[model samples]
Target: MFQEKNRHLPCFAHTLDLTASDNENMKPLIEKVKKTITYFKQSVNAADELRRVQPEDKTLKLKQSLPTRWNSVFYMLERFLMLNKYVASIILSDSKAPEIMTASELEEIKEFIQILKPIESVSKELSGEKYIYHIK
Candidate 1:
């Protein structure tokens, strides 16, 4: 039998996780987004305020990234970007709300989302049962 070390292979999903988690430049901005999301999630009043201000047809809300899931970051950022206007309004109106993201930072998030979209799509495809693995 082959040695266990030689036979063992790293998981593609894990590698993707590493790629997302190891982005040092995004850490600070991600932390800020996380904190803002957490604050809104934890504060009933803030969440209610956000919901109240949001368009009746637009029920989408903020999303928080999960440490264990690599694609969660993409979802979180996507949802945040979608709801940015409402979030900014909340932050402006509420004294207790976290600081709003700057225009440049929001643009950075947009760019980061573009970078992550393919990674997220690939990860999902890899996880699907229909995904084909061809040995080149």
Candidate 2:
């Protein structure tokens, strides 16, 4: 599906089971993360620039890891989780001092942080294995 939609940015590692779905607890936070990713991905040039300035070995590793492995479920979720964690942290840190963000902005990102931390914790526990979350 990604290949059909985004052939130019064909990193086959994206074919993982990484869809956002409604969870009684996780839906809103996951939606926030999805919104952040949409904003981030809009800057294709910047992502490429990040890849370029990265050390050759690091760049090669990223390309080899994803562009080559194209079908690893662990790799895709790991990558997405990594990005989501970073964005959440940035939002959290920026919101720490009230002056850095408007009241409404701080409130929104505060909610974002609250939602994301649990998600981050669960992902950390899963690591390279599949998770089976059961709601009580």
lDDT of each: 0.85, 0.40
For every candidate, C-alpha RMSD to the true structure in Å: 2.3, 13.2
lDDT, candidate 1, residue 57? 90
Top of the candidates by lDDT: 1
Model 1 lDDT per residue over 46-133, tens place: 8998899878997878989887776888899899999999888888988888889999999999999899888888877776646545
Instruction: State residue 99's C-alpha deviation in candidate 1, in Å.
Output: 1.2
For candidate 1, the TM-score is 0.87
Off by more than 4 A, model 1 = 5-7, 130-136
Q: In candidate 1, where is summed lDDT lowest over 10 consecutive residues? A: 127-136
Which sections of candidate 2 miss by over 4 Å?
1-21, 52-55, 59-77, 84-136
TM-score of each: 0.87, 0.31
